[model samples]
Target chain A: MGKGHPTAARAFVDNRERAHWHDTALWFVREKRDRQAGSLPEWELLRETASSIKRHAQSQLADYLLQFEHEATANGAVVHWANTTSELNEIVTELLQSVDATDVVKSKSMLTEECHLNEHLAEEGIDVVDTDLGERIVQMRNERPSHIVLPAIHTKKEEVGELFHEQLGTEKGATDPQYLTEAARQHLREKFLNADAAITGVNFAIAETGGIVVCTNEGNADIGVSLPKMHIACMGLEKLIPKLSDLSVFTRLLARSATGQSITTYTSHFHKPRRGGELHIVILNNGRTELRAEPEIRDALHCIRCGACMNTCPVYRRSGGHSYNTTVPGPIGSVLNPSMDPKEHNSLPFACSLCGSCSDVCPVQIPLHHQLLTIRHSVKEAGGLAGSKRLSMRLASMVFKRPWLYKLTAGLGKCAVRLTPRFIKYSRLNVWGKGRELPPTPRGSFRKWYDKNGGSGGR
Target chain B: MTRMEVAVVGRTTSRDLILNKIRAVELPDVSHPLVDGVLTGAIEYADTVGTFVGSAESVGARVHFCDTDSVVDIWHDICEEFGSGKTANVGIRGLNDDDLTDDSPHSASELVVYGTSGILGVAENAAIWVSDRAINHRVSLCLTQHLVLQIDAKSIVNNMHDAYAKLQDVRDDYGVFISGPSKTADIEQSLVIGAHGARTLDIIVVEG
Candidate 1:
């Protein structure tokens, strides 16, 4: 088996400066989230309430979804459901074709990324321009988003400047963010005006009013949907909530957790299409239904995609998002991806240090670290590890079970470490010794020391 | 056969399959958490208008306070600040003032759109609620160079929970809680004022 995360992370960390920059940058966001969450006196209570609401919604998803469809259809929207990613892509392509749309502008939707909708549409000769500034940057450079909320976190300003200089024809060597943003604004402005259809991802879909909320700092979702005659919104089935009031709970926590902002600049709630316009809502259940059946991983469905877990993950911070090699990355992705395809993504669960920072920062209070631990057991049960590794684990477990054997091995290990030469200790067999040193071995076992200091209950 | 016709064929069957899968989920029922008392105590401002102005300014928005009757004069002042001449593309809607009567809602590249906000403003976040009825076109709020909103100072609330309570029943096709101008920190974590929306947002609070 290929070494998955460690090998990929080594590639990312090869450039020490860039790796350090990425770590510090994400830590800054994590700090900002801490400040925002700290400022709220009822932040913990809010998280509890949000988690409960999501649990209740998921348990009764069928009822809520049907109610939403009824209300939305009554509100003059056409709601479609897809059982797979290809089905969702086909639905979106059909919607665009029905409108005879050639040019489509899309806001940043991780659901679309998951479905690979842009590539699917491109095959049929449809041009979908991503409108979010960061998405647009990465789209032009032909790279996937490294960070979910901040799609281009892996990209440096000079690299962005070079990309814009080539794609948008801005002045060469113009690395100022304000200057680059203005060029994107001018270029995307034209695309927005002439686009025939707009596609967006739903942040929250309210069951009571049949409305979908799309939050953005750049207002790209609002601009794309408002200008076009047809608005197509795609959402995972988990985005549904029972009532409109639950939105207040999520809306308050989402932007604060994502970017340390009190609120996004625009939180647009689209109840229906504009007068004389078409609104198509596509709900996709690609492997999420099976995920909900797994009781151990069902809580992960509560994710609102705020991306706080990613920013707070130490391994993710150093390794970067691309190293996970999944549509969603970080601690949550590690758990969710393996559950979907264990053999293919078995190494993802091993990517964590089990620090539990992701669980603490999660807005919905998903026990992410515990979920990763569970997935690790499942991976082992499936025999996803290499033969040598499995044998090593079995030997270790055998030694751990027998006290005398363990004691003998521990004593021998101490002697072996003390007598080993530096070259042997730091050899290729010892992966941990590459950037670290072996600590000096203790002369005696802790049990022996405890016996000598005080017998049984003397202390 | 056209692509549209082919797509229309499988819509019903796909819907059935998805709903069936959802119905098959047999997990135990989970009750929604009781949030009745969780949001009761919020940070209150002694001076709501003052707090609103400070909060709005902190989020990169310019705030102006004027008496209800001086809204027109304040609009003129804002226009002057934005360097508006007689031939400027200033579009105003939903503000029932004869002096502020520009009716066309066409959003241009460099147009300035003026409108009134729906009831309710959160003091903690300086967010103003605007529904579809408050403006002719929602695109005008986003597709303009600058957005000038006229809000009533008396409608400010303490926090998001209270704001939701006030707007829970009103049914509009579209609405938004705009906190400030459009912004992005996507490039090297640098904050840029305008990414693809209104570059500047001017809030004219009308004192009751």
Candidate 2:
């Protein structure tokens, strides 16, 4: 989707205010992570175990998915399979139509956003409202989430108060967090109680028990799912876990990673609906089967949907989620979005500084930076590289492949840098120099230095 | 009279043709083909649950056994020594109006012993979850700061399925499984442990 408010989204993606806001939000999550990590002595071991469980689940996802479909159907949850986003929309729309539904309440499900569910539902004359406070703010403003956990993070309290004032007509200057929270609570309470259906994202789907594990703060999901007549859960194929026992590691890590709490305010498990309620689980395989096929990049599927990697990523901490132009962003997004559409997302792989902070902090230990590099190489192989970038890389590769030419090229580069005008202090090749001064090239190459020093360089 | 008019109207009307053409058609077989060879178990691993216990005196939680008998005496002494009565709100499980009559002769100082869910180990950061099913009132765990969970120590498991299976038998009412103190560190990296939920948790494990 292009910017809903084209000017605002563009400004948020590229402007300094948005960058600072996103960085602060991510740092908050990072700090939460450190606190949670410090609470448990077995944190590292827990992370390792969690990573292993996710890996196992992703490897046998096909079997587990089939098993889940059978069990979920048996449990009275109508199972829907959608190979593409449009297909997913059609299936969900038909399901809604079967019941003659009009209004839907949704919790914070990134998959629904990924599939553009709200827009499609709107076109069908159904109103979809996001019940989560953060998501509601973003939805009201016609903007996508800037961060997974805190969707409206880029907007400050006053900005939110202003928006709420304009939309909900609260007091003109209500900047109090409690007041704002209470207002949202009252507003969403009505939506949840009245909506014909509820939509949620699954944190973990247990194959053994045929249950969907939904973790949330503020208990919004619990209210949304329990109160509505129909509950629909949309999940990517990768969200499955093999055994119910495996939930311990994920549940433990999710709270610690997300908000530094031991667990969410609510961890709801729905196997089958109650007496009057109906349940539906839509399993989507848009690109995950293909993602599973790439061995080098398959670890990307081990993601626990914890935003820890995004919080710890330097590039993501600087550039908000909107900059990536995908529902999921950061290092994980760079790898995952490309798998869905390499040509469109080729620019994302190179958006990082190759820092390993994401890998270090990842609970599942998906080698995110490494996967981004792998995706870059794959994009290059597929000839998705831009014309100018391809030409530049090709020329550099040619020179480096030939040592004599490389030396000659280095000499010319040094001469050009030395002779450049003051207005052009450094070559555009100098990215680091954009923020800091460039180092002066030595009078000659290292070979010349070695020759003059008689090859005894060290003191 | 209705049949003749209907036949005449049907023969005379393009509306009949339009209505006939508007009959619902069968939908196409649109199920997405399932993909093969998805990896189910090659990624990450972790055990899901953990359990721990602390005495009423040591971890700041009170014990309520519901009588002035020898067990109550022992529990009071333990609560006094552990500083639980000072820090915790306590409860007893499954006691109704019938159980606490004058013949029982419970102590005057014995606080209201509600229901017991399970023992809880609360991190100092003030986060906890107590099973709503386990407690008589959900507020027994939510309203208190330091909770002393008094349960049979053997009930603990390493994952949620054990708890879930246990819950399946009694699905008529509400049940809460608390983890730690209620907490939210969402405001600008500040780890305010007791934002709006519980502040501290201490599980007083009675060995017997």
Best by lDDT: 1
When just chain B is superposed on the true chain B, each candidate scores a TM-score of 0.81, 0.44
Write the residue-wise lDDT of candidate 2 on A73-176 in tens digits: 78788876666677678767877876888899898899999899999999999899997777888898899987787677666778778878898888998876
Write one digit per residue (lDDT tens) for candidate 1, span A1-459: 445887778888888889899999999999999999998888998898899999999999989999999999999999999889999998898789988998999999999999999999999899999999989988999988988899999999999999999988989999999999999999999999889999999999999899999999999999899877899999999999988878878988999999999889999999978656789999999999999999999999999999999999989998999898888999989988889878668999988899999999999999999999999998888878766678878999999999889989999889999999999988987766766788888877787888898777644
Candidate 1 — what's its lDDT?
A: 0.86
For candidate 2, write residues B158-188 as lDDT tens digits: 3332344344433322234554433333333
Residue clash pairs of candidate 1? none
DockQ of each: 0.67, 0.06
Clashes of each: 0, 54
Q: In model 1, which regions exceed 4 Å deviation?
A: A1-3, A440-459, B1-9, B35-38, B41-47, B85-110
Instruction: Give lDDT tens digits, candidate 1, residues B61-149.
Output: 99887886777777767767767632122223223431222332234344654445546788878888888774555676788777777
Candidate 1 chain A: minimum summed lDDT over ten consecutive residues — where? A1-10
